[model samples]
Target: MPQAAKRSNDVPGTAPNLVHPAVVNDDAVRTALAQHMSRISGSRTEITSFGRKSSGFSWITYAFAARSALGGDRKLILRVGPPSGLFAPYSVLPQVHALQALAGSGVPVPALVSSAQDGAEIGFPFFICEHIEGDVPAPWAASELDPNHKRVIARQFIEILASLHRINPDATPFASQAQGADRAELRAITGWRASLARPTARYYPLLDWGGRWLEDHCPLPPCRTVVHGDFRIGNFIEHKGRIVAILDWELTHLGDPHEDLAWAMMPTFNARSRKLYGVLERAEVIELYQRASGIAVSDRSLAFYEAYALYQAAAIQMCAVRAFEVDRFNDMRLAVMASQMPSIVRAFERALEAAA
Candidate 1:
């Protein structure tokens, strides 16, 4: 349950000065951050700028500037997986391990500075990373990108996709964590089945049918590596006309590369222009990825992963609904997400039927 918001001095935004009901707020987070930074750097530290970011539902994300005796001024992000966060049993280890695994792999990600699963110091498990400067062009919003820029960005996007899929899982620390493709598919199915089984969440026939279809048709990937679970247009940071970093690894795991590819092509992530991630056409993306990775993408397998992606998406949204119903978190964002389930299921059904 969320704590009652204590009265405080007027703060600029909705979550400043610990006004937000959740455990992570301006006061608690600032104190915990200073303590952690000081311990890590062996010097006193003071927080300069601190505020909550406006996006995301799974974690309580805050961006702040800190001044330390040794490190000087630094910009960083603090992500706390509150007990009430949308995803329960929050663990920072997987994301931290992923950043460590992808360090030199051409896939751009934020630098992981520190992470702790223990909530003793802070109110929840958390990870901190360098804050990259960039503008996020949301797919839902009108794009201001010119043709040349779009083409350039699209090339980079496809190349990065290729690079991400090309990383050899055996060489990295992810080898043990990498469930062979078959087990990965089974885990996804069982996990979503359990989330939907929660009585509070409304049952949707399309989701059930879609899940069954996926079980009967799950594909064994040509190979499995690190799947960035949510790789789409809006999840990256665009700075000075190029994509600098890919953000949001909460859903990341070791699975089929096609999962990431199909996820990027999901219609929910598309806007009016609707090019692959609002950049390249689907054919262009497939061609570039195939040429760069030297792996032929099987269309049959892509269809299976595409349906799995939709099913996973619906399960995620329903998790939000379950969290809300159980009074785990009171954010209206979860409610809005729950409201989108029917449409998401409809799309999933349509895709499944077409594939059938």
Candidate 2:
């Protein structure tokens, strides 16, 4: 939950001071945001509280409480893609289109308020959405869940994923990437491998080996659908063992459905309980997804994607390393990602050895 900043004198356009230590240049952000909200809503708006929510390397999130004459009081989330973020030159359109299309589709997602591709709004590509109240359980903390609650969450997790993959790709921006199974696999490999060039121009032997192995073992996907590229335990909000909303659609795209299954099965995410996400085993995930989607799961395809998942995870860590070293991103979480590289390499190596 985001805490409200202590109030003081008002900024020029804002109703009151909305300053937080984590927010850089709080005055400027408050004034600009107030003006933008007023113009969009056609009423005077005031941001009463603003606080940074997550230190994620890709996009900046802020949870704020606001009030206006037209609309009483409400909580909303502001997501911005800054120039120095890991994935630079970002656009929020893909996320916007997907959320719009998924409404009432049985998948829990926050309501989209507004979005802009151009940086004119907040000096960056950004969007605002109605805030959902829930707690995000860290991957390692999965063991702490109550036994009954864990069972309920595990069922919801796979069911929601199956529902997402059943949506028509043509209705969303991801249709451009829904070429085929081969293209989807190759696109991910090529893009992530290219990202390795930015972090000091150094060679990564394990990543190179894993990438090559993925290409050699690529399997035809069971079905190509919309893949929630980051659909793991920690990304969803849960309240009373029920998922209220699935967060972080930045990496969502059209690809092999198994890619998400493989990501959820990663051992790094199952640290404490040793089960996938500390609730289900590998076989259980495949069985549940197959029953729900009616798409058979191929063990070979899952194996191939598991390797690709590890490779992609390593590449993303490299992005964080570059953000910290070269872009001078202040989030220490990015710096910590540098230390997790070795563990990823070891996991990649083990996956290959077992597959062999």
Q: What's model 2's lDDT at 184?
A: 63
- The pairs that clash in candidate 2 are none
lDDT of 1: 0.76
- Which digits, one per residue and each the tens of the lDDT, describe model 2 over residues 1-61? 1112434565788776544423334467667778878888889999999988876556778
Q: What's the number of clashes in each of the models? A: 0, 0
Please report how far candidate 2 places residue 274 from its true position, in Å.
3.5
Candidate 2 off by > 4 Å: 1-24, 176-182, 199-202, 325-332
What's the lDDT for residue 171 in model 2? 76
lDDT tens string, model 1, 1-356?
23323335656776435344445466877898888888888899899999888646667779999898788999999888875455666988777877888876698888998888886467688899989998877777625657678678768877887888888877766677764444666777977877777767477877776777787777777877677778887888888888898887876767778888888887677674547756688888899889998778889888777778788988888887776665445567777887788788877887787667
Candidate lDDT scores, in order, read 0.76, 0.77
What lDDT score goes with residue 253 in model 1? Answer: 69
